[model samples]
Target: MDLQKQLNEDMKQAMKNREKQRLVVIRSVKSALQNEQINKGSDLTEEEVLTVLNREMKQRKESLHEFENANRDDLVAKVEAEMDVLHTYLPEQLSDEELQKIVDETIAETGASSKAEMGKVMGAIMPKVKGKADGGQVNRLVLQSLS
Candidate 1:
């Protein structure tokens, strides 16, 4: 099933099972997808769905960090729960070593020799790593390799 349909089905199951937290997260995801469709005036491809999922996951991660820093553990826990539900749709992330290898290859492929070429390397690498690795991780790897 497509990601949106699967999410809807999971939302139904969550409601049936009386999983309030899970249902909330699923419904939020569904609402986001629907909003995107309406705004874009088209159906989302699987990759587009993944992009939306990743964006939401990133937002949750940032919120979690902020909440933790503010010592709002209760809010942190809630964001963490939502993050867990969002992550179920993401692809498996690359390990540090694997990410480094790809960075190296991208640098080589793009002939990027210094930090100034960071953009070139990133542009070349992001498509290969998108939905599989976090942007901050990828940027760090690229910087480390380039520097």
Candidate 2:
């Protein structure tokens, strides 16, 4: 099933199963997708939907970190659960070796020979890595290879 239909089915299942937290996260995801569609005045592609899911997952991870620092186990658990739900919609994550290989190829493709050309390399890499790899790790590996 496409993501929108899959999300709708999951939302219905969550409601019927009385999964309050799961239902809430699914609803928030639907709302974000709807807002994006309306803003752009078109239906979202699978890749576009994945972008929204990744953004939500990233936000929850950041929240989870703050909750951990505050020793709020309750909130931490909730955010983690939300992140778990979000993960179901993202593309399979890239392994470090796989990511490093892609970064190296992009560096060569962009003719980026040093740290000074990091912007060119990054611009070329982000499109390929979007929703599949973490930006920070990508940046770090790019710097390591360049340096």
TM-score of each: 0.97, 0.96
Q: Write the per-residue lDDT of candidate 1 for residues 1-147, one digit (tens) a residue.
A: 888888988988999999999999988888888899898899999998999899889889999999999999999999999998888888899999999999998888999999998988889999999899999999998998877
Among these predictions, the greatest TM-score belongs to 1
Cα lDDT, all candidates: 0.91, 0.93
The total of clashing pairs for model 1 equals 0
lDDT per residue (tens digit) for residues 1-147 in model 2:
999999999999999999998999999999999999999899999989988888888889889999999999999988988888888888899999999999999998999998999999999999999989999999999999999
Candidate 2: C-alpha RMSD to true structure equals 1.0
* Candidate 2: pairs in clash: none
